[model samples]
Target: MSAPIPVKVHYHKQARELELIYENGERHRLSVEYLRVFSPSAEVRGHGPDSATLQVGKKHVGLANITPAGRYALKLHFDDGHDSGLYSWDYLWWLIEHREANWADYLDRLEAAGASREPLGIEIKQL
Candidate 1:
């Protein structure tokens, strides 16, 4: 297979947006909400198959900062303080390329399961 043409990644913390500028000079904007819900952290992506941890309420989350990892990948620091997963060039590229389709599928999963992206982890208080 041919190698990727190499792309440039840019993060705007205030806007909670990430962009990938491809070799072809095309740029793609990736939203913070999308990155959070699809976080690659161990907290979200488990060690093994079927061990995936589904994230909720991340639709409004955004990037806190970005750390460079060598020259082929990035260490994404989410506003939620998650920085475990290292997003490789291929993975990030794939995400940027397929963001729309994947996000739609995620929403569909929630709807089909009668689930929501709202918080389910809030502590309840006794009346």
Candidate 2:
């Protein structure tokens, strides 16, 4: 089975989400923080599962840029200075398929580590 191809990709800065429209007429939206924490980059994934780093205080992280990495992957640049992940088409499909479970597991891990998704210091809000 091959990965589903995305016909369109849009970044909604206000919403902080990446929207993907697939050839099969399916659409999915993923948050920037979610993508960051689940990045395929070695910095996030590490050498293996046991070495994987937990990305904390990323609730307010934003997507700085998105560039195509050849024809099969995307290079996502985060505002927090992370730009090493290469999100392949196959991997992206898997992420969309397992988003809920993965997010839940991440939250559990954060709780266990006594960490938080909230950024440190005052997060000023605009009215």
Candidate 3:
């Protein structure tokens, strides 16, 4: 099975959503926060096994830009200054297919680490 080509890619700033339409007739809508935390960059995925970094405080991260990387992938720039990951077509398809399970795993990890998705400075103290 060949990878599906993206027919349309639209970023909705206000909603912080990246909408993708594929030639195979599949449409995937992903949140900016999800994309940030799951970035395929070395900073997030790391250079080696057991070195992956957990991204936190990105619940409100927004899309700044999206640039095509040759004919295979896309470079996503985030409002929080992250612009390294190159999201490939295959990767994107995988993301869309496994979003729910992946998100659940992320939440579980965050809970295990006592991490909050809320940005640091704006966090409210719960006394």
Candidate 4:
């Protein structure tokens, strides 16, 4: 009836990913860049529809920390200095379910906006 809470939450620093394991033996991993780009914070989500601030140059973003926000959500601290956003259990599950589609959508948005995921000051140019 309710969203399932992850039984285990692990951040793989080397892999730059967050791993979630549910009680039902389901597992999911979200990249740091993906999490950073899709943060629930108003800075990322904006105040309403069509108002979200496009996050660019976050491919190298790392998780500085992940703290619990009471018992219902998580407060993610990104190394890039973004500390807002409360990722609730329902949202996490939703992300797990929609990872692929969400990623595709994000990429499409980036393309439309002429944004690059590479961190600022670093560009890969092929001649």
Top candidate, metric TM-score:
2
TM-scores for all predictions: 0.78, 0.94, 0.91, 0.92
Error of 4 at 36 (Å): 0.8
Give the lDDT of residue 17 in candidate 4.
96
Q: Which one wins on lDDT?
A: 2
For model 1, state the Cα shift of residue 54 in Å: 1.2
Estimate, for each residue in 1-127, the C-alpha lDDT of model 1 and write its tens digit.
4236356678876677888787888887788777777777778878875887766666556676788789777788776667788877777777877888989988987787778776568633222
Query: Candidate 4: what lDDT?
Result: 0.89
Report lDDT (CA) for all predictions. Answer: 0.74, 0.93, 0.89, 0.89
Query: Candidate 4 regions off by >4 Å?
Result: 122-127
Instruction: Between candidates 2 and 4, name the one with more favorable lDDT.
Output: 2
Residue 51 in candidate 3, Cα distance off native in Å: 0.6
Error of 1 at 37 (Å): 2.0
Deviation of model 3 at 49, angstroms: 3.5
What stretches of model 3 exceed 4 Å from their correct place? 122-127
Instruction: Give the poorly placed runs of model 1, Cα more than 4 Å off.
Output: 2-7, 118-127
Clashing pairs in 3: none
Residue 50 of model 1, lDDT score: 81
Cα displacement (angstroms), candidate 4, residue 100, comes to: 1.1
Q: TM-score ranking from best to worst?
A: 2, 4, 3, 1
